[model samples]
Target chain A: MNGNESVAYNLDTEEPGAEELRAGFTALRDRLRQPAGEFVRAKEFLIEKALLVCGMVSILAIALIFVFLFKEGLVALQNASVTDFIYNTSIQYEYDPVADETVAVGESTAYNWQPVGEEPKLSILPLLWGSLSIAFLAAVFSTLIGVAIGIYLSEIARPKIRETVKPALELLVGIPTVVVGFFMLAVIALPLKSFTNWLGLGTIYVDSYNAFIGALGVSLVIIPVIASLVDDALKAVPADLRAASLALGSTRWQMIRRVVLPAGVSGVFAAVVLGFGRALGETMIVLMCAGNAPQMEWNPFLSVRTMTSTIAAEMGAAQQDGIHVQALFLVGALLVTITFTLNVIVEVIVNHYRKKIRL
Target chain B: MSAASRKSLQAVREAVQKGDRAPLWAAIFENIVRGFTIAVVLMLVFILGTIVWEGVPQISWDFLTKAPTDGMREGGIFPAIFGTIFVVLFMILLALPLGIFGAVYMVEYVRNGPMARVIRAAVNNLAGVPSIVFGLFGLGFFILFIGRNLDYYAFGTPRDNAEAQLIEEQLEPLRAQYREEAIAQAKIDELKGKERGDFIRGYVAERMPAQNRKVFGQGAMFWAAATLAILVLPVIIVSTEEALRAVPASMREAAYGLGASKWQVISTVVLPQARSGIMTGAILAVARGAGELAPILFVGVTFFMPSLPLTEPVNFGPLVIQVVNPFQEFMHLNYHIYTMATQHPDPVGTRSIQFGTTLVLIVITFMMNIGAIVLRRRYARS
Candidate 1:
């Protein structure tokens, strides 16, 4: 009846009586098949809910991950005081002979992460240092090369060159971190070590699996991420800005440096931050190349362990419900917190830039 | 045509010529940028070239078809290759539909709502979550929680953790015995000036019971595939959403004009138009799944899985048992490379094998990526 009313209203201008009568009868017949309509409605409702749930699954997964991580990690943190857990240099837990439990000791606290010793030290500072130094080096190397490539693609390259090079650069993203790790370990590390030795830099020994090599391996993975992001940002800058700068008697390079780069500065920053997040969380490359020696050192040539590598290398053999396992989970929790915050910041910055450009 | 006007015009021409010359620093900077771009391309070439140079020689027909021998120091990586393919296939099966549906909800059903924003943020954060964390999550949730529960419900008790541990403990003596035998055999081979470690190993292995080899309740192909599905879910959802968004509004409007419902319009017009894009996204996700090693490291991947995932026919007769069990441990190319490069007794000896395995993985992943890219290009042109 409702369908008929709407049909009649529409056909009133064309053929009033006969058309309306036929449509009303048809609509009445359709209404008799109300179960089919209900079936369709039910199917649509099912699909909508299924999709909604599917979309929300990621959030659920992340929340569950955080819950599981904290649940496992908090037990260890309870035993290892949060401040000592965070700031103490050594992961060595001194056993109180009288109390029959591991406790912090010594007048001068040491910074080592020996989670599997007589006195298990769970200091995360060294791991943090290793992770930060590698991530910093990787970010610097990747951003320099990535931003350069982006600039070349957006401002300098010919159309044909751009077409060929852009996808080729994207292909870099598909290379697995495992392969990169293998390459570093197998092909690059030895050669690089020998090369560094050949340079005759006295007292500067390059370990085969050092932070520098790890950074290089990680840089390879993050470069494409940064390049593509920066390219997008650079491309988003208005063509009119470049044209105006060029018309004011500036060279092409000057126009790009002054007008385009400034306009896309926020986007470039977001790209760099995202790249840092990527390098920070990367596991396989660091695990294979970063020589899993947790130490509080900034020397690029020395072996250092990152949070990701530590988790990967130790999680398998670590006893379930042991302090070591819990400590690893705590490291994972720290990683998730840091990377999540970085991603959120990057997203906010990127979104704000997009809005500004749109306005 | 006056002399003074001509002189002034000549000076202006000189000035224009001088202006045409870019500043030296700018030229140097431009070249440096260009060089960096070229360096990126060269890096790709070098990586591929090195792998091919070292790997191609080892990839014979026998290498492709044969199983690994001598503790993976010899023979082919057939099991690793097969396991990678199977896991990637399973990952796609689980991730593709869920990802497409999620994208559809984001693009078609939900507009700029708070729920949509939350979902988007979740996906972004998920993408940033370390691959190693995914490994931990897999071990903790999929294996420890879901797997243990499944075992408890199926077998009517918690999986005998003690029994599994007992089996593992039992293997330690056998491994020590084998190692002693290997050392003794190595001395014999050295005295004889020949190689007999393989024969000695085979002889030692013959005395070990099959029951001693069985392991359960921890690393499994099912859990690995599940973890990988979650890992690549963001990739699939992001690409699928982009594809769905690329579908023109006109198509939906046209369907609506024909009195079609929203669901009908999407099922008929929008889905068909975005089919290629969805395919591309699925392929790309498969490519990523194929290459991912971190998530599977703890979930199920092993250094050496002598048998295939599917158990072979027990009796080689007309009536045979063909069981496709997903709970078994499997070898993967990436994990194989890791173990060979790191855990092998002789890392230098296994260099060729490692390179060969890496090359195979690279080839498989590149093929998938190229397939997706080609499909995208064709569809985009249309």
Candidate 2:
């Protein structure tokens, strides 16, 4: 710019603001500053770093949850042995007068979860049985209905019905579980029990708050979850695949069963797995209605206590640092671990399914 | 293709050629599935109708305005409503920044990489963690660890808040009568002595609590809201991530072309476009977190609290303001319903009131959820 200005001055001794023009151009370049100034760079760097940290909070939260649960749960270990924790209740011990020790032998197969009895039992098997049975039963019922609904939404529904029903189901899912728990406890349990009794099936069904009742309550909560998940999965199948199936002279059912369902099977697995995880960890409904007997029986007709219900029902009453609190925390730890692992599985399956299915 | 699929295809071909039974049978199957969907929808309607029908008549103006009496059977749920609002406000306040920033990082910065994959997996896991596990963490971490440390460091000892308040109240007259005048006179007299120092020292120590009371080390609304923030984080992140993803890449490039920095481009361009999405996610997360009882069950929520959770009204000379005190253990509508159904001495008698509270909670959550969904759909379309 100085050279050009000097040449212009040499050519015509006029317009002597060339030096000012050069300064202005230099100032403009400084203002543009393609490689921005240090403070701006520092601020950008700091914000980027902070955002990355915020984004990583989920992983940090999972770790923290695991740490805190185990830190509290391991308190029980300070009081009892691992064997005692795992094997509890219904052990018949014989005291030999000569031996002086109350030992001999007894089968430790029985699993009792009586955490507050004279001799507190901490076996998780009863709770496990309850959770699995309830989850499985709920899964079986909700899946059949939920999947059918999903298929209908994805394939057979008229546009208007689909539009209305999908949002309704979404709203249904958003209804709090506490409400469902209330409905089960106050509305469903006694009436259903009486109906079963009038039909002479109450004898088998045991009580008002049987496992069947609680499972049905949970099914109500998870049905919408599963339906929405399955609907999304089926909707994710490529449009051309459906069109091709129809073009091949296949019936609509044949198209769904053969083409769309096959394509979305992995997604279905992801949805079912997620649904099972949800049911397994469901707390309020089971806590309210499942009698909480802690019976080791697998019968759906009988009362049982699930791991989640055990935590929800007993955690508040448990002494802050007592063995019961530790045990409850351990149950929570176990529940989270299972659900966490289930999520990992679902993620892997969905990732693979997405990669395969996306055109 | 697999043999089963191949055979199914062949079966489809033969059925189509026959055309006699396939279409009719398919129609019946389709009808059955349609019936299933209708049944599910109808069942939802029936349950919602049951609650609204049973609950609406029970809800009067007094029901919304008054507090429960006669062991929670007689009056309204104003405290629960207030506490629920408090928790949700704090929940969204904490969650929105964490969630939006995190989503911004994913969408605007780490578009795709191993880092993105890990972040996605972490989010999915967090979202899938059981609400009850969140309760355990709220107790173990927030109350036991953070709140305990807060009390230990700030307050010196775990002491009763009422006693402390009582001491302050008692000392008020003493200060007005003696301490302030005495100190002022001492200073005026230019008496620099141990007497004044001891008197002043003694005056302040008198306000220190003498009785046992739990404070931050126990359940409080702040901790419960914090726990709920974590609970709803993934919901916000996932939706915001999608919303950010939807903003066209060309807009970002255009901002850059105009000599904007990355942050400037994002804030001025990307975020404005995604504002509705973020708002929708915020509402949805609040709706999701507020109705949850598990995280708040032991974290802060009380089964019976006679008063609302607001602080004493502050007078700014002419104007006065009162806000919720987040440190207090408060009542929540969901927990109220839980307690009413299960812990009431007379659950049968309290049934109507329980329905009333449940209806309020149901209405709030449903409105938020449906509103978010509607907004998202409308925004996506336009």
Question: Each model's TM-score?
Answer: 0.84, 0.85
Q: Chain B TM-score of all predictions, in order?
A: 0.79, 0.81
Model 1, residue A152: distance off in Å is: 0.5
Q: Which candidate leads the pack in DockQ?
A: 2
TM-score of predicted chain B, candidate 1: 0.79
Give lDDT tens digits, candidate 2, residues B88-169: 9999999899999998998889889888878887888888888999998998889888887677667654433454576667
Error of 1 at B334 (Å): 0.3
Clashing pairs in model 2?
B159-B213, B160-B213
Q: Against the true structure, whose TM-score is highest?
A: 2
Report backbone clashes per prediction: 15, 2
DockQ for each of the predicted structures, in order? Answer: 0.49, 0.52
Lowest lDDT block of 10, candidate 2 chain B: B155-164
User: How well does candidate 1 reproduce the true complex, by DockQ?
Assistant: 0.49
Per-prediction interface RMSD in Å: 2.3, 1.9
